[model samples]
Target: MFASGASRRCFLLIVFLLCAIMSRSGVQGGANLCSVDFEVFGNVQGVCFRMYTEDQAKKLGVSGWVKNTRQGTVVGQVQGPTDKVREMKVWLSKVGSPSSRIDRAVFSNERDIPKLEMRGFGTRY
Candidate 1:
């Protein structure tokens, strides 16, 4: 029993040290970091879509930039935890601002990233 207790304590200590190291290195606790670029089509422009996207991304702890495309679409790249990025994608596809109509959400250029490229969500001109 004493040996088991000692082994468990050692394991916990190792995990704690690894967590501290990852934190100092600016990495989430075993969470994958990734980026995805998406474009929303149909009635997305001039409807506060970008603002809403920024808000959602910030709420989800996603770091990236969003912009309005001249082609009447909203385009953006989001980088963060895989789960949070997926959540953001769902939000963009289904619940985009109260005023905007999201017809189609197409995602592309998604890949694992070493780190976040942006600090917070922002609307790009």
Candidate 2:
């Protein structure tokens, strides 16, 4: 009886752990729960800012894309470890476009784009 009880407890624990892992990855849970969105404003256009951002994101292993808006802003989506996303924001502000000025940056947990493929953070049409 003692051995059977121990085995049951172990099985329950394993099941709980699996659920937790799956939830964190947004696989079992709803999508956009683990991703981050960023809106970068400034002299982000016309200075190769998009290319620079793409390079940085790829180096940091961030999965997302950067693009320019008609209103002259740079918008990007980065999905990865939360820490890495935060670090990318810092890098963008400090090492972004030399000719461009990063006037504002906004971070949100809401997932707007769905399953967007990002290849090295380049510009999108």
Candidate 3:
């Protein structure tokens, strides 16, 4: 309902300011950067869990590293847009691989990071 020229100008200014603020907060429109450390337990090893994780992460546009722990667990970090990271979490908790059973998924140290640390998803070793 901006009828006058001055009113339209004011509306545009407000829109611009809002965009600038959102960009500065690691949020570009609806996207935001996030990071989380995760540990997966249960029959995760010997089933190509890391490979499946890398595949899923790349599909979802999340970047990080996954590696098999000495304690028979899988540990890794995931960093990406908030929505993509959440999707990755869901995948980790439910669908690990066709042959593996996920008993527990421990997520911790989750927070909004400044930026992504990895370029693409890959297995560390």
Q: State every prediction's TM-score relative to the real structure.
A: 0.79, 0.63, 0.80
lDDT of all the models against the reference? 0.90, 0.74, 0.92
lDDT of 2 by residue, 1-125 (tens): 43698898998999999988887776663444236777888888899988888888888877887888999988877875556677887877667877888888887764444544454455576
1-125 per-residue lDDT for model 3 (tens digits): 87899999999999999998987775674457899999999999999999999999999989999999999999999999988899999999999999999999999999987677779888987
How well is each residue in 34-62 modelled by candidate 1, as lDDT tens digits? Answer: 99999999898888999899989989989
Report how far residue 72 has shifted in candidate 2, in Å: 0.5
For candidate 3, list the clashing residue pairs, or say none.
none
Question: How many clashes show up in model 2?
Answer: 0
TM-score: model 3 vs. ground truth: 0.80
From the highest TM-score down, the ranking of the candidates is 3, 1, 2
lDDT of 2 at 70: 94
Q: Ranking under lDDT, best-scoring first?
A: 3, 1, 2
Worst 10 residues of 3 by lDDT: 23-32
Report residue 81 deviation for candidate 2 (angstroms). Answer: 1.4
Q: Candidate 3: lDDT of 103?
A: 98
Reference-based TM-score, model 2: 0.63
